[model samples]
Target: MKKIFLLAALIGFSPIFSQERDQIRERDEISPDNSWLKVGITGGVPVGDANNASSFALGADIRGQYLFNPNIAIGIASGYTNYFGKDGFDDFGVIPAAGFFRYYFTPSGLFLGTDIGYGFVTNVENNDGGLYVNPQIGYHNRDWNIYAYYQNTFLETDMDIQNVGVGVTYNIRFN
Candidate 1:
């Protein structure tokens, strides 16, 4: 009787063992492989104290990333932001040229990143020079990415500006 009971237990456990083995195999098949160059365009509005006004800006960035492992990638991007105003030359035009480090937290494409660089604001009456740091949170799916970020601009002169913006980026993937 004891032998019969042992045999039944082993038969019932066999399917679970098979499933575990299949899962291991599938995981190995899905291991991370990253070898691609990604380019994207972003457009959004900037709200700040110095501008005291709302303006729209567009940017373009290109990145070359090496996927060391599945979930980790490091890359650099250079981009520009142009701000337009309605009336005259006091409207600030900012060109943001920066480099960034990025990380993916999930395979579904959620990410966190930080960028540091110089922001050249042209056509300003009082101040024209500043540096900026932007920390951002974003999500990417197929060909679309969107983010919300805070920008701190430290001017060479006394006046400084802080901006909060939400942006949408579209990715153009070239094989």
Candidate 2:
């Protein structure tokens, strides 16, 4: 009876022991290789000192990013932002080319990022390019991103132009 019981238990447990171990998966399942391009549109209000110069802002941008891991991404971005003058001021635009870093919170789809680079002034005479910084927070999924940001440009003329804005992006995955 003891020998029969031992044989029965071993037979019952054999399948469990023979199965392969589970493999670890990447945090973001959307991209196995982790590279993508994002194209988007932005709209917002000119704020603080910028409000006196312009009332509304509108723009479009494109970004290329590589995910170093599940939580971190480094990228380059370029965009055009047009500020509509309030009344007497002439309408102007800025073409911003920036390098950025982003940190994502897993499962929550939330991210924080910052862009630092140059803002080349356009459409208005006598104004020159300047350094700019944009800090942002957003929520993203496999194919979409929605974010809000504050962009500040420190111009050569001692004027600081800033905007409070929201943007939405569609992501295209590569591998």
Q: Show how many residue pairs clash in every candidate, following the order shown.
A: 0, 0
- The residue-by-residue lDDT of candidate 1 on 43-104, one tens digit each, is 55666555554366555655555545556656565565555564442456556666666677
Candidate 2 CA-lDDT value? 0.86
Against the correct fold, how does model 1 do in TM-score? 0.62
User: Relative to the unseen true structure, what is the Cα RMSD of model 1?
Assistant: 9.3
Candidate 1: what lDDT?
0.64
Task: Identify the runs in model 1 with alpha carbons over 4 angstroms from their true place.
Answer: 1-37, 86-89, 125-128, 170-175
Give a tens-digit lDDT track for model 2, residues 9-110: 999987766552222234344363578998999998998878998989999978988887778989899899999997799888888889999998983499
Superposition error at 39 for model 2 (Å): 0.3
Best by TM-score: 2
